[model samples]
Target: MSRAFTFPGQGSQAVGMGRELAEAFAPAREVFQEIDDALEQKLSKLMWEGPQEDLTLTENAQPAIMAVSLAVVRTLEAQGGFKLADKAAFVAGHSLGEYSALAAAGSFTIADTARLLKKRGQAMQRAVPVGQGAMAVLLGLEFDAASEIAKEAAQGEVCEAANDNGGGQVVISGAKAAVERAIEIAKTKGAKRSMLLPVSAPFHCALMKPAAEEMAEALSQVDLKAPAIPLVANVTASRVADPATIRDLLVRQVTGMVRWRESVLYMEAQGVTSYLEIGAGKALAGMIKRIADKEAAIASVGTPADVETILKTL
Candidate 1:
């Protein structure tokens, strides 16, 4: 089957995610070491033995998830197993996981990605004061309906759709009052459930303009090369590879809706029948099923056992 490699974003992280893979492969261990050297922090320790709140911090979670994803990529390429360039038609990532997809496709060095994500996390957190911004999930509503709720709730504030996750799940982000208003608006419009998300910032809304500016400067400093395969950008929901275009989109993504549903649909139209989620959790896999054909195959690769099992099938 034609396949794509995908990466998970925040909220997929958990303690002990990459520990087994690190133990199973020297290459996997090296991925963590490279990130540690780049950041000069014991992030792996935090990931392996987390005090959940600390590990869940944006600064830590961003790079930490990318590290585990790269570790899995390294392990799969070992023992003459599946080659990402040969086996995948495209690669995609959700939110911060986009960095992981680029690293997997050779767009950025592991160390550089790690450093960038750390800065990205810090910048995103600094963009708005805590509790001033918020995100909410409006279940049982299509993206268009959720977007309308965001617009109506803005009240001259900054509410906007952040992630159109499909499966009747769309996330809204913006000013706290605006987000709270969106919840009421969603309920009034007959949403099955409307609840606030526990995210630190209102990601992917006009309010994130400041964070987008920070990413613009950070991305300019980094050297991004063409990927081994085309990447379906989260913002555009289509394939892109030109380094300049990719850089521009990365900045836009900070303030653009993650068009996840359209992204999966685009991949399926491009003949990607299998989506391999290359990191911490099954979130992306579930979304793909919701967005595309339910029969579309899906898998995850983080531990040694996953690597071995997938290799056998490949």
Candidate 2:
């Protein structure tokens, strides 16, 4: 059966995410070590033994999550004998997880991806001053309805839908006042619920234009190659493998809504019935189940034990 490998982005991070994998496998440990060397810091140390506040910072969380995801990929290749180029029909990730997907598909080296993410995190955080921007989840509303609500609530401010995460969940981002207005308008428009997200900045909105510009310059210096397998890009909600296109889309993704639900649907339409989440959490797997229904096969590969368990599938 054709399968797709997906990675989760921020908000899936937790203390001690890949600690077990590192302890149980030499390859996994090597992955962390390489990332540490690339970033010239012991990010794994912070991830394993977090102050919580620092680890949760966007700059730190982005690369840390990619490190775990790449470690999972290394384990699957070394121990599980599942070559990503051979098994997965497509690869995708949410937001920063897109870096992980690119790394897995061979568009970027693991070390390079780590460094890029660190820069990405910092760029995103510094794009808008804290409290000037905000994001919120509006549940029980279709994207069309949510878009209308966001536009209506904007009132000439910068409010826009950020993530369409499927299952009636849509995240909106922009100026704090506009986000607050959108929340109110969403509730009045019959949204199931609306609450401000505890995010440092309003990502994937017009306010992130500065961040997108930052990424464009940063990405230009990075070595990008065509992925061994196709990558379902976040911005376009379509599969793209060309290196130039990948680089361009990555910059655009900073201000583009994460069409996760649509990406999964696109993959499903392409005959990918099985989805493997190769990362710290089972979040993408859960989202796939919700988006694709019970018939879709889902798996999570976070540790060496999970690698061994998934060997039979290959």
Candidate 3:
């Protein structure tokens, strides 16, 4: 079966993530060390021994998650003999995890990905003032329906769909007041449940134009190469490999909805029967299984144990 590798985004982070992998494998430890050196800070330390609040910050969480995903990839390379160029058909990721996918596919080095994500996270957090923006999940609703609710609830404020995360789940983000109104409206419109998410910013909306501009400048200076495997971009839900196109898409993604459900469906249409989630949490894998149907195989590889099992499968 053809396989696609995917990565998780922000909410997947947890304290003590990647620590087990680091403790179990020397290669994995080196991944974290390199990321720490690249950013000139103890990111791994913060992730493993988090005062929770600090690790949960957008800046710290972004790079930390990328580090963990890279560490998992490194462990697979070293111990499982799983070469990325040989195993995967394409790579995709949820929101911030897009950087991890690009790094894995050779669009950028791990260190560069780490640094870029640090800047990206900081920029996104600073785009809107604290308490002025918010995000919420509307469960048991179609994406178009949820988006329509957001548009109606906007009432001239900025409310838009942020993530179409399948499994009847869609996330909306924008001004706090508009999101609050959306939650109430979604419930009234036959949504199973709607709850406000405790995020620092209203990500992936027009309000994030400032962050998009910042990323355009940052990405312009960074070294980016075409990936060995095609990338399923978040903004478009389509495969892209040209370096120039990838850079432009990354910029737009800051102010665009993460078309996650459509991304999986696109891969399925292209004959991808297996999806491996190579990151800290099993969130993406779980979502893929729910969205892509039981006929597709899903794997979560984050630790040495997972690598060992995958070695046997290979």
Candidate 4:
């Protein structure tokens, strides 16, 4: 079956995420060490022994998640004799996980990916002052319906659909008041439930314009290469391999809706019959299952044991 390697995003992070992999594989330890050196911090320490609040900070969580994903990839290659180009047809990720996917596919080096995500997280967090912006999830609603609710709730204040996560889930983000209004509107419009998310800032919306611009500056300076495999980008929900276009898309992704549902559908249409979520959590796998209606094989590979299982399959 045609396969895709997917990466998890910010929310997938948890304390002690990579401890098992690091303990079980030398390559995994090296990958974590490299990321720590690149970021000039003992990020692994915070990851394995965290005051949950500190680790949950956007800057820490973004790079920490990428580190775990790359650690898994490295362990797979070094110990299991697997190469992404030969084993997967495409690579994709959710939001920040897009950087992890690119890193796995060789579009960016592990060190560069770490620095870029550090900048991205910091930029996103700084885009809108805390308490001024917010995000909410609307359940049992389709993208089109969610978009209408965002528009109606905006009342000229920037409410926008942020993530079309499929499985009857759509996340909205914008100015706090507008987002609050959208939640209420969504509830009135037959949504199963609508609740504000506990995020530091409203991400993936126009309020993130400043973050997008910052990312443009940060990305332009990086040496990005075309992935060995094409990337199913979040902004467009389509495959992209050109370095210039991918760079542009990464910048736009800061403020653009994460078209996750469409991205999965596009991959399925292109003959992807299996999806491997190579990261800290099974969030993407869960989403893929819902998007594809369990017609495709889905696996989450984070621990060494998980790696061995996938290696046998490969």
Candidate 5:
């Protein structure tokens, strides 16, 4: 069966996420060590033994999550005799996980991916002053309906849909007041629930234009190669293997809504029958299940034991 590999993004991180994998496998430990060397910080320590505050920071969480995902990828290749290039039809990730997908597919070196994600996190955090921007989830509303509500609630502000996660879950981000306004409007427009997200900055909206610019500049300097497998970009919701297109889309993704539902459908239509989430959490697997066909299988690899278990699938 054809399978696609997907990675998790923010909100999937937790203390001690990669500790088990690192402890059980030498390759997993090496992935964390490489990342720590690249960033010159013992982030893995915080990830394994956090007071919770520093590990939760966007700058730290971005690369930390990627490290775990790549650790899983490296482990499968090392011990399971699994090769993504030979087995997977496509690869994708949600938000920051895109870097993990790229790195796993050999588009970017793990070190470069780590450095880029660190910059991305810092740039995103600095794009808007905290407390002036926010994000919220609107459940039970279709994307078109949520988009309309966001537009109406904007009132010349920056409210916009950020993530169209399947099963009627839509996330909106922009100015704080506009986000709250959109939440109220969504409630009136038949939303089952709308609540503010505890996020440090509004992401994937007009307010992120500055972050997009920053990423453009940073991405220009980073060397990118075509991945061994196709990557379904978040903004375009289609497979992209060209290095140039990947660079441009990554910049746009900073301000573009994550079209996750469409991306999953695109893979499903292209003959992918299974999805493998190699990361700290099962967020992408959960979303894929909601958007995929009834027969599609979804699995996650978060620890050394999971790696051994999935070997039977291959």
Candidate 6:
């Protein structure tokens, strides 16, 4: 069966995410230690024993999620003898998870991925002041409808579709007023439910232009190699393997729509019949099930038992 490995994004993070993996596998512990060394912070501690507020901070959450995802990958490699290049037809991630996918596929070192995500989180947080920018979920609306609603709500401000997560879930982000307006507009337009998300900053919208610019500079300074498998990028929802092009896409992704639904569809079209969500949570697996709408094999590998279960299949 053709397979694709997916990674989770920001909202999937939680305290004690990788504690099980770290305890169960030496390689997992090594991954966490490497990330701690790279960032010069004991992030694993915060993740294992957190004040949820601190772990939820964008700067902390982004790399923390990546660290857990990589820890799982490392465990799978060591325990299952699984090789991504041999098994995965493609890899993809939502927002910051793209870096996790890249790190798993060997495009970037684990340490570099951790550091890059740290910088990305900080840049995104700094792009706009808290409360000035916001994001909202517009459920029961298609991407086209959500896009129009965001446009109408802009009112000379910046409101745009951010994440086209399938299952009639779309996230719009921009100026707080604009996003709030979009929520109300979505209500009038037959949305099942519309509510503002409690995000620190507007992500994946024009308001993140400064963050995009910052990422461009940050990505330029890093050495990125072509991945062992092609990545279905968020901005394009298509396969990309050229290192230079991938770097550019990562920059654009900061302010561009996360075409997650389309990306999954693209993978399905490419004959990816099995998807492994190798991360902290099963959020991506849930989305993939909705997106594919087929009897595709989907699994989440985050713990030792999860890893062993997948290994048997492998």
Candidate 4 stretches greater than 4 Å from native: none
The TM-scores of all predictions, comma-separated, are 0.98, 0.98, 0.99, 0.99, 0.99, 0.99
Where is the poorest 10-residue window by lDDT in model 2?
A: 75-84
* Distance from true location, Cα of 40 in model 2, Å: 0.9
lDDT of each: 0.92, 0.91, 0.93, 0.93, 0.93, 0.93
- RMSD per candidate (Å) reads 0.9, 1.0, 0.8, 0.8, 0.7, 0.7
Which scores higher on TM-score, 2 or 3? 3
**Model 2 ranges off by over 4 Å:** none
lDDT of 6: 0.93
Q: What is the lDDT, from 0 to 100, of the residue 313 in candidate 6?
A: 83
Which of 2 and 5 is the better model by lDDT?
5
Instruction: Give one digit per residue, the lDDT tens place, for model 2 in 264-285.
Output: 9999999998999988888777
Q: Tens digit of lDDT per residue, candidate 1, span 1-314?
A: 98999999999889997999888899999999999999999999999999889989999999999999999998888855556898899999999999999999999999999999999999999999999999999999999999999999999999999999999999999999999999998988989999998789888888888889999999999999999999999999999999999999999999999999999999999988998999888888888888889788888877788888888866
Question: If candidate 6 were superposed on the true structure by all CA atoms, what would the RMSD be?
Answer: 0.7
Q: For candidate 5, report its TM-score.
A: 0.99
Q: For model 5, what is the error of residue 177's alpha carbon versus the real structure, in angstroms, after optimal superposition?
A: 0.2
Displacement of the residue 184 alpha carbon in candidate 3, Å: 0.6
Off by over 4 Å in 3: none
lDDT of predicted model 3: 0.93
